[model samples]
Target chain A: MSSTEKHIVLAENLTVGYTPKVVSEKIDFQLNQGDLCAIVGVNGVGKSTLLRTLAGLQPKLSGSIQINDSNLESYASSKLAKELSVVLTEQPASKNLTVQELIALGRQPYTNWIGTLNEEDKKQVQESLTSFLLEDLQYSRCHELSDGQLQRVLIARAMAQNTPLILLDEPTTHLDLYHKVQILKLLQELAHRKQKTIMFTTHEIDLAIQLCDKILILDGAENPFGAPCELIEQKHFERLFPAEMVLFDAKTGSFKVNK
Target chain B: MGNLKPYRFSFILIFLVLGLAWLLNISLGSVAIPFKATFSILFGGQVDIESWNYIIWNYRIPKAFTAVLVGGGLSLSGLLMQTLFRNPLAGPFVLGISSGASLGAALLLMGASLITGFASFSFLNDFSLALAASIGSFLVLLVVMIVANRVKDTMALLIIGLMFGSITAAIVSVLAYFSSAENLQRFIFWSFGSVGNLSTQQVILLSIIVCVGVLLSIISIKRLNAFLLGENYAQSLGVSLKKSRLIIIIATGLLAGGITAFAGPIAFIGLAVPHLTRQIFDTMEHRILIPSVFLYGAILMLLCDTIAQLPNSANVLPINAITSLVGAPVVIWLLVRKRKMLF
Candidate 1:
């Protein structure tokens, strides 16, 4: 709780699941303020599920999730929403909402019952638009934006919420290489400069290892949470994918297929 | 400056249209009263007491009020359903609530005499049918909510809703088969949909129900806006998905069920008005969308009612028939245009 010891999220023996089915069990972890974390795993390895559980989007199976010392379950949804924001992969189906209007949705928890945006909310929305370099497309409809632009718009919305902890599910899923690096770099910069904790799931293990301060690697059998260098020294990357299909090139610190 | 100016203009335009529609509704029924006389009678000025009483109290006032209530209620329900499911096709009819009400009304009409003879209950003969229809709509709403909760995909939920509607329609068809000729005629007339069926007392009751529903919707606007992103997103935003969905289902049931109980399955106002409101407003912000839809719905229903009551026509057209005539083409256009744009 000290100024330097900014604890953003804490999970103790956390188990995440849908009803009657446990995805992962007995997980204990802590995410501090200014931590850029990546969750990497094979397909169907519960990376998304774990992130959702931390964000309070999905119910926890057992144990507790604490955000900033208060139990996650005890925090009122609106109060929790103010402290934590989430960006999902699903594109909203609504057609007419503009980029600014879409990003303004982040202020919904703060807005009154009538859903009107106040001046402060509008200022935050503007800051988000500017920070994400989306000024030109501010008035453009969401349907008209490219997938990459839409992803940025969604990120901008989460940013606008000004939450200490931001959870994203595959932020770079549909982006090109340039935008992918740009997004990861932006997230890293956010952690460093804005002092926000960002946890995102990604398939780009190399980029995450290179940019993230901490990594939670889920190998389906054993999940490890620690610094990237520690995980790398432990040779965790070598076992991440199938042995025959792909191999981790330790010298380049990237994944290369043997075929 | 100009962009904000147009929104103000659109607001003015909507109000103007609503006012004009109100005037048209009060002045142009089967018993044509002069607009001036209607206004004078409404404003407490003394006139021909009998005609004034008949026009102001009996015919025009109740009909106008019914049009407003039914139009506003159905459209608001449609807006909420569309937002809740995140499907453009979601509406009261899609969820099968209307057909459930129809089936309930059909059962009452077909079995009223038999029940009256056996039970000797006077109020049962009068209010039992509406009560049954409301309960039926409420049950269908519950089922639809359960199905929606089970499904993750919005499009899949829409299909499930459609299937529910078809199931209710099938039940209604079975009930129709067993009904006597006289009851069949009465049920068929009810199914055709009409605002004129509401008496003053019924209009007052319907207004109370619709007001409650609209008030609930207004209170939940912030939650509804959160839901636009999807249920998970809404939950992460601190909305209790289960509670929000329950409130929405109840609101939808009350509005749809109450309207269907008296007006008999009025269609298209809910679906079409929201689309039109969103287009005119050029924003998905529900603060504007909700009120815009209310006004647009009232006007649209008023226009439909006027068209149904053609001056030279021997028989009034059914309200549902008129609304579908107006509504179907718009939906078809939405589908066709969406396809072309996507392709």
Candidate 2:
């Protein structure tokens, strides 16, 4: 790590899971400012669980998360909100809300009693809309937007929040290939240009490898987290998929299923 | 700039409709007073008889005001519940608050006389009944909030609320079975929901509670909108999930419980008014939706009250029954057409 680098998120000995059992344990991870990272895993390998733990959406088992050198638990929810923004995969059922209104919700942390958007908030919201190319649909209802469009709208909402750290869970799950690339590109741009530490969980390992600055691979059987290159050099990727159908091609840096 | 004029004009038009509805409600009644005479009576002008003044001032004004207050209160609570639960079908009735209130009222009406005979203490009077209903509804709200806090899934919370409502309804049914004949009549009448049953003092009390609740809800607009995304997202926006939930539950209890105490368990306004407001304004900003629903609900309740008072030879129809006649079909149509729109 560079001496000048500021660690925005640090997970020490973290254990994440739902009721009855733990998904993973003893996890230590650190995300520096402006780092674009991806958490990669197969289905049910606890990618989302890890993200939720980092985002403080779930209680950690015998561990601590520190954001910006402060204990995660110590930050009041609103203060934490001012520092971090989260975008989940589930769509909100606020059908009557227009795109602009939905985006305006990002300013909730800063709004007064009446929820009025001030000039600065308005500028940020407008910039988010422009960056997401959603200006055309700003007046459209969320229910009327396409799945890809809705996903962009949600991202715009998070961008409008203007937090230093952003966590997304399967943001491109509903997007087409073109939009998926577009979104990943946008996230990469956000991390570099806006100096945001972007962490997202995705099953698209190939795309993640090409775009992410660092990849945290969670192998269900063995070590849950390792740098993408470390895992690849260790030949851990081969065992992630079944041996018969798919093989990890180190040359191409991708998995190819035998047809 | 000129195109935006229509939006302003439509807003004013809706306001005018609400004003006209209020005026018509104040004027037209069984006594059939002229508009000018009613205005004069309201503004302290000459009236033919003291009885006319007394009827207009004491009876009609309070009754009309009760309708508006109860209407606005129920609809506001409905809007809040729908937004809080993220379910369009979720309202005071669906979440069991109305049932809880009804059970409390039934207990007061049915169990009071027996308790008074045995213990020489009367706890089933109207004021006591209103208090009991408020407590009962608030208790249900507390339970719902606890469940919502524990469960992250919105659909699961909705299911739990429905189950709670059914449980409260079962309790009310059991109370109905053991009640005396006269008490049963009173309980049954209260269950049908009427806006005209409030005495002047009762109207004043209900209005105060409803207005306070509405004001609290108004102040919670930002938090409520944040909640539109779901609890986690709302929390991420710095909203205190527990605090917001408590405020909503308390406000909902006050509005629904107060209305139920006096107007019985008024239905359909809470379920139908928010949807209508959403359709009219084409936006979900609570700043607009809250006030719009209030006006729309008031007009709807007044219109239903008018229909209930139609020239039925023997008696007026129950207000609940009349509202259902109008509201049920609209709800059914919304369900059919926008099957997936609602949560």
Candidate 3:
């Protein structure tokens, strides 16, 4: 551990769920810059709730979340937009928008009232498109892209937002195994290279285990946060799902269907 | 995505169409002024016939102006509605602004006789009609704006607006039931819609109201663009959802209500113009669609108004009738041609 590194996101005893209903509580976690954390849990276990709370989209039932030393709830939306970006699971309303235009919207927080992108904004958008391997698809309509390509464009949009932190909810839900791994690998590289704190919820335990720098596990047992190897040692995945449905392989750090 | 070729082509084509439609509309009416005479009079040259000058300057000019302004108003409202609801089928009238206007008109024209002789303003007076219509539509707009802030869901707001429409329609029905035959006929005539009825004063007032709505739309253009991704995404971009919702509701209400007050309920133009604009442009960016829809909407209204005043016949069709007849078929054709929902 680097003792001098600063924590970008800090959450303590967060209780998140729908209105008047509590799903989970006493969740404590902290992520330093350049740390790629994955929130892993079974379906309906409140992974999305936790992410939404951290993103400041949903109000937390109880507990505090701080981003870059400021309270998440206290920052004005536009000010927070500059510090944190989010990629949702659902698709946008219209697919008629071009990839470049869609990506250009990431500069909304900094753009003039009319949303005109200046030269610096354009340069950032271009760099994101090129770095994300979306240069060729920049001119294509969003509706025309493959699912994988769309996800990459969305990620590029967040990168263009120039936020210090990014949170993606179910970023790999519908992709095939190869595409899922490819996306996870790309996210891993983005976090390490850019030194941006990135966190996403996923069910791809094996890929996440291999790629993520830190694993935050929410299960029927105690919520655990640590390095992936440490999490594997603690057998967090064993408690992740019903044993009757899937079994965790401690040696492989993967889940397999129980015989 | 940055391709300018298609945008440049469409812009030039729509502008040319507007110019041609303007010239043709001014020239064709009860009497053929001849293209040369029309051009001369338009450019400050005195024409041979004096009545031609009166007709062109006094009547045709106001009529054309109303068509353009009312058309632009309706289309801008429709564009805002579709953006707010995220559905192509949404329109200004769908929110019941027209019904509200009708209720106001019905109260003045029909309810007057139902209540008492003293209560009944002259049904034939245009001033009373405009006043009542504007009041009624403005009242509905205020209610709709409140409901918009309360409800986060656009679909629910649409249904609530529809409920408001039915309630107003019910009151109008009661008024119509009690009205005398002469008053009923007057109300029916007013409902048929006439673009030529606006006096210069009413047209000027209408222009001011429409300008207010257009200005609001301009300020909300960026927020509307973020809306293409839905509310959650828009909020993420730092848009004040409450503020945006209020601004949009007010703008839509002003445009729809103001036009209905001056021109009666002009149908189908509000709903159809935006769809056609989308089909022609094949893009959903509000920055492009707002201006494009406004220009195309103006051209469309001019063409429809000209058709209503057929060259030789004295029979002037109701502006609403022409719009619906032409607008409905074009939308159907575009739908069938695309074979998919654009939204």
Candidate 4:
């Protein structure tokens, strides 16, 4: 459709995996402006691989990924940096960095050669801090903050980057359930309010169903992505995991273990 | 900006200690020049005796100068390596860089002396030793850069480096076994590590190389700070990993290699000084840590060199022994206290 043509990400027959191993092939997806999408699947279903491929950290096994109508591989690294931002699952080597200091690092790509933050850059960082409700914790060292607070700071950094597309790998990996939902809801709010495309990989299926505008379920050889209700209507969520004890309920948009 | 109160306090304290250490190193050697005479001689003013002027200007000044550069350079490299590999125990030698230098020195000091029967050429004229050390460290740098590309994990890279160090050290031991007793003593004396070894021209060369290293370090601080959060986070923040890693490896090689070539592989100042600076400054920001470590390292090395002189005795102790003795305890204490750190 003409509507999907103005996408932030336009992937055509994209195949993704590490070198010498192809996980998925001939897959296509278009994530349009302001779309908050979640890639949900069981463990080892290549959710991370797909996110990484799209982030341009790893080479796409086969096919093309275009951002802003240009091929992903065609952009220079510095140019690609401004267009795409990523939040990783790996833990930082904490050296007692303050919340403000950590968030300001997001301006690195935009900053000059010496990495000095200009007046406008500082203002964006401040806005990100306030919007994330991290003004109070801005002076606190990362080690002193709770997991929830640190996760918020990471997301704030992503927001500060001001990229069109934000790729996060398991943003809620270490948080409590409440914090997990809190983070997801915040991201959902940002996607609509800022008119940015945000895609993240998560195992939090129910929360993804509730918060994401579109759900991308990474099943073997299938690229199921559509409006959450559409995926539920088509019974794609039910086909997600072939586990004996677990089941997906379309009415609740959640999973239950048959105990 | 965060309040500069801590930075201000540490700056004054480190500067004061550095001044005191400099005075101590100059004034109270085995031949005790009076404080006034040492001061006068240092300031290019009148001293009681001409010999006292020579002692202060020729011997102690160059010695103290060497200490400052060696200390400052090694500490900077240590902090860089520790952050790069994200391992606390990783030091200037963790990558076998210094070991590579020692290997070169060993081949010359022990091996060549055995084969050619020309050991202890002149204790003060260590031209061969310096050249051997430089060549050896450069080879290791090459090998390290090659291996660094192949391994992504820091732990794997460190282990590979340690293996290389072990191999080189074993070769040194083999050289030592076949060498004569006099050659062994000369080699041991070289291993003892002296700050007074460099002549003025050598110190000038050392300063030039170390200046380049320190400048490179300053340039890499922002990237290194990002790296404090690990490689993935750094990459996500748009840091070009391969490029940054290359710069770090080369910068470290220059810093560590230059010092070892001139200063005889001095130990533990690199390992311990960065930790001390971090603990004292209470911040891990590389911008602050670089200057802090440089000043603190100079102070500590000057202090150690003083102790090694033993003040009254003509017999000076080996510097490596003193550094290990003083440094090992602080590291142990830090580990015992923190209990929850790897980087």
Local accuracy of candidate 2 as per-residue lDDT tens digits, B216-255: 8988888888888888888888888888887887888899
Tens-place lDDT per residue, model 4, A68-125, is 8899988877777788888888666764778888888888778866567788799989
lDDT of 2 at B283: 67
Q: Look at candidate 2 and give me any clashing residue pairs.
A: none
Off by over 4 Å in 2: A220-231, B1-11, B114-122, B147-178, B311-314, B339-343
Q: What DockQ was computed for model 4?
A: 0.51
Residue A141 of candidate 3: its Cα lDDT?
Answer: 84
lDDT of 2 at A145: 85
Top candidate, metric DockQ: 3
List chain B TM-scores, each candidate: 0.89, 0.90, 0.90, 0.91
True contacts kept of each: 0.66, 0.69, 0.55, 0.38
Candidate 4 residue-wise lDDT, B46-158, digit = tens: 96689988888888889998999999899988888888878777787777888888888888878876776666477425666677887888788778667756776667777
Q: What class would a CAPRI assessor give candidate 3's docking? A: medium
Candidate 3 runs further than 4 Å off: B1-13, B116-119, B122-128, B131-171
Best by lDDT: 3
lDDT scores for all predictions? 0.81, 0.81, 0.85, 0.83
Per-residue lDDT of candidate 1, residues B200-298 (tens digit): 678788989999998888888888877777777788777888788889888888988988888888888888888877756766767677788888888
Clashing residue pairs in candidate 4, if any? A93-B229
Task: Report the C-alpha displacement of residue A136, candidate 3, in angstroms.
Answer: 2.3
- CAPRI verdict (incorrect, acceptable, medium, high) for model 4: medium
- Provide per-model DockQ scores: 0.54, 0.54, 0.59, 0.51
